[model samples]
Target: MLFRQLEYLVALARERHFARAAQSCGVSQPSLSEAIRKLEEDFGVPLIQRGRRFDGLTAEGERVVVWARQILADRDALRGEVDAMRTGLSGRIRIGTVPSAATAVPRLIDPLCTRHPLLTAQVMADLASTDVLAMLREFSIDAALTYLDDDVRAAFRVVPLYREKYVLLTDAAWAPVRGESVSWAEAAALPLCLLTTAMRGRRTMDAFFAEEGAEPVARVETDSFASLIAHVVPGRWAGIVPLAWIHALGVPPGVRAVPMADTSPAPEIGLVACRREPESVTVQALLAAAREVDLRPLELLPRMRMPGPDRTRGSGQVGP
Candidate 1:
């Protein structure tokens, strides 16, 4: 079948609407349909379940769609590789990241872009770790910045970036004495705002609480770290966030971040890419960039003295 026909089939599978699929492909509805019909003739199978409106794909169509995605991804990779060999890496690298890694992803992308100025980075943050992996499997993203668990390690090629450490973020009025670390039990006792249960970071935090025999209930739950931070800033609720978050996005005035006293080993976060036979050049470049990232700033976050109430908002400076 022609590549154009495969493109139409994939678009139809994604949009699930004949008109919309044609619109997305920048072709008329009849043209898209004719292409699909021709593709079916070539394959000798019915790809789509026919109806007046758009029906679901046939079992054969479903299988073809999977192959289509892989073929398209490989085709793009070939183009990217040729372009990079002639010029520099000049295409968009779509990245999917969990919200907790918001601060760390930049360390990977910034260097990649600096080295390859023609490359563009598209970051989709606030996804759950599981969702990030799913997107990577579906070829929706070029790479992922997420927790490196056993499943991830087994499934993808992982380049460990940094271990994520937790901290308690709250208004200074509600914070512990300066330089004092907060325990899981102590953090759970506070009126806390946390990520929703859907997020892997929240699940990790919940496990920590379980280990401490503390089942602290959240006063507020949200999927967005920004929303959780907003709740903590009000002085009525505290939040558990990655220490790297404070280093990346400093707290506003009147807010303080206390290191978590838990001795449990932190979870490792990493750059994950599919283990295809011929990986995309952009993905390879990203892996190289990830290896060269300076994680010392994050490593020092726990030992550094966090700013006190007197410190200026968003200064991200260590106190003496």
Candidate 2:
């Protein structure tokens, strides 16, 4: 069957309507319908459940849609490989990441883009650890930056970035902690604005607190670090954030990112990508750039000071 027929099937599965799917594909409804019919005839199975209106895909259709997505993705990767060979790697590399690791995307992109002037990078953020795996399977993202958990390490090719260290970001008025660290229990007692449970960072924090025989009840829950910082900057609440964030995105006035005393083994954040034979040039460039980065020195640096002009946040490229 033609690739266009598979494209039409995927579009129908996504849009769930004939006219709308046709509109998205920039084709007439009758044309799209005819294409779908032809696809079913070729496959010798009904792809869609028929009625006066669009119902849904049959079991066979659903399976075909899955294969169609994979075929399309592989086709695009093939084209990208050819383009990279003819004219250097020159396509967008979509990088999905956990919220906490969002700030570090530039460190990876700077070197890659510098090497390939034609390359562009898109960073998606605030994704759960589970979602990162799902997006990779669906080819929704080229790579993911997240904690290097066992399942991820086992399934994909990974590049270790750095171990994430936790710190309690609090207002000076509430807890004046400078050049000193605080224990988890003490921080838990203070009014807090925390990342929502959906965030992997929040889950880590919760596990730490649970071990201390206490549960953290946040006064405010948000998935965005910017939102957490906004609440903490007002001098009434605190947030538990990664030290990587403090170094990458400086804290605002009245907020101090004090190191937590708990010295358990922290999770390592890394880049995860699909393990394909003859990997795409875009992914290869990213791996090469990752090897060049030295996060060891940054990890050894002292806690970040209050925000300043030189300590500006990232370019706001991180997704929600």
Candidate 3:
């Protein structure tokens, strides 16, 4: 019933324990446990299974946890709206972006941070589309930079931001590509290092490969997109990557991003947020900012180079 109690429930769902969840919420274990009990009493059903240690949530508890997230997100939105009315706009915003967007992040985050000095900004690197949805659902993330198919993500708020197509980045040896497009069977024959099967991007590639009834070889397999860019240089190896990343990440000098013809593989990447609730200022700013970027296909330019400053290896691995 109470939002704070719902917060406790969400926290418990995340941490799966009272003491840890309470610590995260900055409350004592008993107080937090009591809140959960009260919520169960209010609902007339046990939310959590109790034992010497925290077992798990009941079926009712699992359902309530989803409601709790939605309710909490609504509360935060309401608070943000009221606060915005009073003050010029000050609130923390959490964002989850795909690894392919690494180069675009600084361009986005720097301007936002500059515009709102009082606001806190947290940027997380996310690689999986499912994880992106989960974070948005749990209110752990305000918005995610990803693309979703209707079946995969029909419930959330989606804004079409950019449609990034895949490009084959190869070392200089293969330049002035033979055809207007390349096929998966042909692509498979070329020496290529690709992202592991874990990444959605990789899976997307695999699907394309499957369509051609061919599988590409990965002499070098990495979870890092940057590593994919790094490994496929002009002289030796090749990789398949999003064109946006080439410009965003400033591809290595030896690498060349050649658009795969015959196979026009384009995935719609966008800003995904919870349509169920009003967005926070930071989240709103992100949406506004995303609209500002007039992103187009990277290979449109006949000749271009990766210009952005290279970034340090991200501390977090791409989560599925």
Candidate 4:
């Protein structure tokens, strides 16, 4: 059967009405009916159950519907692959990022736009590692910049850009002094206003507290990153902030961030994408630019590698 016929069949199966499905496909009722008939003839099966009204599909019809979806999805994917090859990097790429990556996008974008003038990027923010993995699997996003969990390495391709350290934020006059650093246990006991439990950053901090054998008392919890900073104003409360954000926002007046010392106090944040056989040029461009982005003063660094199935390339042992 033709691609259009399969598309019509799938649409009809979804909408369950010939006229509505036809309208959805921008085709007439007669055209859709004729195509369904053609598809049945091609498959030697009565795909749709006929009645005076909109009857449902037969047993074989359901099976054919599954194949139709696969064929249509594959057809579109094939077209995209061919188009990208001929036109350079010109398609859309959806990316998932954490709240902290907002400032870094311009840096990454500056170099990317210089190379691929026709390429377009859609960067989504505030996604956790779990959300990132789900979106990548659903094909909702081409890649994600999120925390790198150990299991993620086994599930998809990951490119670690940097390790973000947690810092103690407080106003200068109200801040505690005489210590080079503080442990998570000491920090937890203080009255603070931090991110709510919904944010993955908070979840990480909770885990750190669990390890340190302390429970924090947070008077105010907010979802917004800006709110986290706002809470730190002049003894109202103290909160945790990523070093990247401090670099981007600069040290706010009356705010001093002390490093967390005496313990390993950082988590690796990185980019992840599906390990496609023939990665789209747009994806390749993003991967290349991500590698080249400056991530110094931070602990971890991007382990640049060419797009392939080799684990060694992405293992941080080598650079592309």
Go through the candidates in order and give the clash count of each: 0, 0, 6, 0
Model 1, residue 156: C-alpha shift (Å): 0.7
Candidate 2 lDDT score at position 280 = 74
Q: Identify the runs in model 4 with alpha carbons over 4 angstroms from their true place.
A: 1-81, 299-320
Model 1, C-alpha of 12: deviation from truth (Å): 1.8
The candidates, ranked best first by lDDT, are 1, 2, 4, 3
The parts of candidate 3 lying over 4 Å away from their true place are: 105-117, 152-154, 174-183, 233-236, 277-282, 297-320
Cα displacement (Å) at residue 187, model 3: 2.4
In candidate 2, the residue pairs with backbone N, CA or C atoms under 3 Å apart (3 or more residues apart, or in different chains) clash, namely: none
lDDT of 4: 0.73
Tens-digit per-residue lDDT, 178-291, candidate 3 = 555667777888777888778888888888888888978878788887777777653567777776675665546544455665354467777788765345666787777677
**lDDT per residue as tens, model 1, 44-97:** 999999989888899999999899889999999999999999998999999999
Clashing pairs in 4: none
Q: For residue 248, what is the lDDT in candidate 3? A: 63
Where does candidate 2 stray beyond 4 Å? 15-20, 28-30, 51-54, 175-179, 297-320
| Top-scoring candidate (lDDT) | 1
- Candidate 1's C-alpha runs over 4 A off are 175-179, 302-320
Residue range with the least summed lDDT across 10 consecutive positions in model 2:
311-320
- Please report, as a residue range, the 10-residue window in candidate 1 with the lowest summed lDDT: 311-320
